[model samples]
Each structure stands twice: as C-alpha cells, then as structure tokens.
Target: MPSLWHSIPALLLLPASISAVTLDCKHIRVDKQSFDLSALGGPKTVHQLQYLQPSISNTTFTIDICQSLKRTKGVPKSDECAGGTRVCGIERIYNQADDSSTTERVIPIAGEFSTSHGRAMDPEVTRLKDSASNSDSELEGLRVELHGGKWPETSGGSLQKAIIEFQCARDVTGNEGFEDAAEGSMLDIKSYGNLTRRAGEDAQEDDDNDDDEDGPPELPDLDKGKSLQFVSYKPDSDGVGVLRLNWKTKYACEGAYDEPPSGGGSNKTAHWGFFTWFLIVTFMLAATYIIFGSWLNYNRYGARGWDLVPHGDAIRDIPYVVKEWTGGVVDKLKGSGGSRGGYSAV
Candidate 1:
C-alpha cells in the first residue's frame, strides 16, 4: 500500500499545470522629418540638425562626419566630390571661391544631429539633387556635417558648436538596387535631432507627480502560509521558451520563526493546561490508593488481645536435713530430767 508520502509527488505535480506568459521588446519607428528646435531659441544662439540611421536594439550608436572632396581645397580625393578645397569645420565654413570654383565644388551638406535631450534633426533631402549615376550598386559610405552661425558674427559663439551625422545604406540607383531586384534588403536610417538641456523637463515634473501617486510596497501577512508553484512551457514545436521556479509555502515568517502549535491556543496556555490536568490526575490516583489500602487492612485484621503463662511443677516436693549438734543438745535435756528424778528418790 502506498503511504502518505507517496501522495506528495502528485501534490507537487498539481501546480505544474499553470501556464506562463511571454514578453518581448521590439524596435518601434517614428515618422517626423524635423524635430522642433524653437524651444532652444533664446538669447544664446542655437544650431540644430537631425539625422537618421539603423541602430542595433538597445545599443549606443556612433555618428560620423565626412567632408566632400569637391568642397576641399585640393584635387578630388574621392569620386563623390570634384576637385576642390577640403574644409571640415566644427560649425560654419565660408565659401569665398570664384564662380568657376563654386560650380566645380559641391556644396558641403549637413549631417544628422542629436543631443542628450532625446531630440533629433535630419538632413533635408529635398535641398540637394541626386548625383548618383549608378542605380544597381550600393552607396558604401555617406557623411554629412552640420554648421551653425549667425549672419554678422564670424566665430566664437554657440554657432561654433556643430553636430555631424553619418549613415550606411545600399545605393538607391536603378541597376542593382535591392528594390529593383525584388530582394527584401532593408535601408535603415538613424536620425539624431537637435536637443536642448531643458528637453523632457515637463515630462520629469510629471514623473515626480507619478512617483508620489505610486503606493508603497505591499507587506505580506505573517499569519498565513502562501502556497505557490512555477512551471515551464514550450511556446513552439522547437521548444524554445522555458522557465523554472520553486514551489513552496509563502508564509512571511516561515523561515524566520518556529512552527506554530496544532491547536488554536497560544503555546503558553496549552503548556499550562497540560500541566494542570497532569497534576489533577496524579493527585486523584494517590488519594484513591491511600483510601483503598486503609480499607483493606481494616477488613483483614480486627482488634485482638494476646496472653503469656509459665508451664513447670511446684517447689514443695523437695527434701531437707538438720545439723547433728542440735540433735545431741535435745538428748542431753532428756538425760538431765531423768537424773533429777533419781536424786529425789535418794
């Protein structure tokens, strides 16, 4: 026959039937050409730029700035730009060349810009014409730089600060373009908009109110033990998702204190009651034994007297003799009486 311990395996198996819920995080995209930088328009001149590119999920990305050789001061170093001066400025670059050089030199374009304030500014694609003649091949590397400056001041101001953005994508030309070939090759663009230090301040204030609205952590009841169990599940035929956890009582003090008594009474009360009952029963038994013993002795031997006497003959049966000198004196007295009668006869 199976014992009670055998049923525990089945009891433990009961909680395994519970199902577990799955959670996943995805990359969401936003559609907005330029983030507003008017919030940053103040006494301090603010230069803003935005760009877009592909980003690995939950990772920090690096943005690069590339200057076109057409805009440089020498012969064309790269095919994207013609022979010109290569000028890379943190912010603004002045174009002082003549009309011939200006026609030969391609204009320096602005890259994407981002800041810690979570705002971004992307390049305006409509401002420039597409010069890529090849349609089928991929555009290996493209760079853009952003310059901020005022009309009058030449240098040394907030305009001096500029952000550059870079991105990599397939050349959109018609020859070998992924779209033309019917392959689902994706073109990912990462964007960094202009950000101000004061961005998200209102959101932070709302966050403070939310913090105050949130309640305190719930306290577990110390009285009852909670029974909980965890189970694993397979979401797909390949058995990809699996989880494990312990099944046990969830009493707040189970691990902290001694086990409570089975009875409802407090420990001290139970102990005192047990001792009292024990003493009462012992006293009763002792009293009963004393009374029963006295009754038994009275019934077995009543009050009685005992007598003792001697068993021997009387002393008068023994014989005795007188001394010989007393007997001679009696004989002399009789002879003297006879001698007196003879003297009277003479």
Candidate 2:
C-alpha cells in the first residue's frame, strides 16, 4: 500500500500545468509640463499641470487645478502655492484676486487620441483639480480624438513613441481686480511597443485535423478491478490530448482541468474537523490544569500535621505563673499581659 504523501507530486504537477495560460499586454506613458501664470500681470502664481487620458466610454479629457502652496502660519514659501478648496472647470479663470498674495493652482489637460484600429480609442487621463477639492482628489477625463491606427503590430518591434499638442490659456486677476491672460502651448506624448510571440503557437498550428476522427475511440474500462488506478493522459506532440492508459497503481492520480472541479465538500469537512479537535483539546487541557491545581492545594495546607509536645496532668492542674503576675504589673503595662508568654489580658 502507498502512503497518502505519494499523491502529493501528482497533485502539485496538476496545478502547475493548468495555470499556464498566456496573456497580452499594452504599454502607455505620459510626460509632465510646467506653466507659469504670473507673466500675465497677475501675482506670480505657479500652476501644476498634468494631461489626462480619456475614459473608454467618453472621448473628452479634462484639466484639474488647485492652490500650489498651502498657507502655513500665514507665511508664504517660494515652493508653496495658494491653498484653497474649490474645483472649477478648466474654462473657469483660476487665480482671481483674493486676500492672499502668493497663489498656486493644479490644472489638468485632457483630450482624445486615435488607436491603430482606425476607430477612436481614448485612454483615461487623470488630474487634480484646485485645492478646495480634497488635497488628494484627482480629476479624470478622456482624450478628445480617438487613437488612430490599427493596434500597432508588435511582430516587428514594440511601439517607440506617439506625440500630440494643444494650446492653453493662463488668466490671472490682479490686486486691482483686473484680469490678465496669457496663452501657452501644451504638448502631450506617449510611447508604446515591447511585444513577444505567444507561447504554444507552433504546437497548435501543427495539429492533424484529418486524423483526429479516425484515431482510436478512447474509453475507460469499468471491468478493470479497481484497487487504486492511476490514469496518465498527455497532450500529443502537437499539444493535443491523447489517452495513454489506466493502470493499477497504489495511488490514484489525476491532473487539474482548465477549470477546477467543483466539489469542495471534503475541504470544508476537513476544516471543521480540525477546528472541532482544537476546541476539544483546548478544553481538556484547561480542565486538567484546574483539577491538578485543586488536588495540589488540598494535599498542602488541608492535610493535618502531628503535635510535637505532650501536656502532663500535673502541669495542666497548676496555675500559670503568667496569671499570678497581674494587678500592678498589668496596670503599668496597660493590661497588655506585661509582654508575658501564653496569657493575654483582655
């Protein structure tokens, strides 16, 4: 007879073979741009800008803005931008004349790009709106134009880079409440390409379709007296299925299918059995400790010991000397038995 441990190798091999599915991936990247609005006669306000990708559903992109410096103890630092809570659309003029001198805002730029499919494929672009919105909040939008081109073929090589450009306006309100505007150019670009050939492609291509039907009719024999039978099935040289044999073996081994077998009752039962035994063992140990402690305590102080000294009858009849030394001595001692042994005055 074989031990249950003998089946572990087969069990391990099954999952490894089943988990070997291949996947395809696409790569994308975005670059950061900086813009200064102070050139428009407004307080030199700095804007943190990011271009956003479009959503799969929507083809529009968006720009988010926020105060760059947060006010700390009323002191403005060079690196700090204006801090406030408000998310206005990109069209809304940021940096209006407020009480504060130093100001900053976060802005997003969004538009669409075309994909290789000749159909529009918009990537999601995300940005942070102005400060009044949560400091960590991000504004998301889609590209304005659909990505043009077929999914770039990766057979030759990975995509190198793609570029796009647009125009942006920076409008600032001065201390006198006069607004000034400056137009600057915005450029957005991304690069793609890093492709590998799919695995198992050659094997799939070489399968013999004509001989598939004329091949042996594979069937399991019920007449085979079952001790523990191991079935070994292997994919053909072309990565196809071929039944080898059902042999009498000490361990019955099977491999994992593309999908896992659904009967999980045994696993649940084993978990419950483990928990039940754990609780039983825990309670038994606790009870054993409690009983052992009670037994030890009873054996210690609860057991009586023998008296070492014996009292004679004559000694018992005689009056105690401590009793005779009473009155004056007792009074001087304040009736505390004069610190004598045995007799105590109450």
TM values, all candidates: 0.13, 0.15
Q: Where does model 2 exceed 4 Å of error?
A: 1-266, 303-346
lDDT for model 2 comes to: 0.25
Candidate 2 lDDT tens digits, 215-308: 2222223223322122332343643222212112111111111112245533343344458658866765654553444345446645221111
Full-model lDDT for every candidate: 0.25, 0.25
> What is the number of backbone collisions in each predicted candidate, taken in the order shown?
35, 51
Top candidate when judged by TM-score against the true structure: 2
Give candidate 2's TM-score: 0.15
Question: Which regions of candidate 1 are displaced past 4 Å?
Answer: 1-139, 146-166, 171-346
Query: In angstroms, how far off is 63's CA in candidate 1?
Result: 17
If candidate 1 were superposed on the true structure by all CA atoms, what would the RMSD be?
48.6
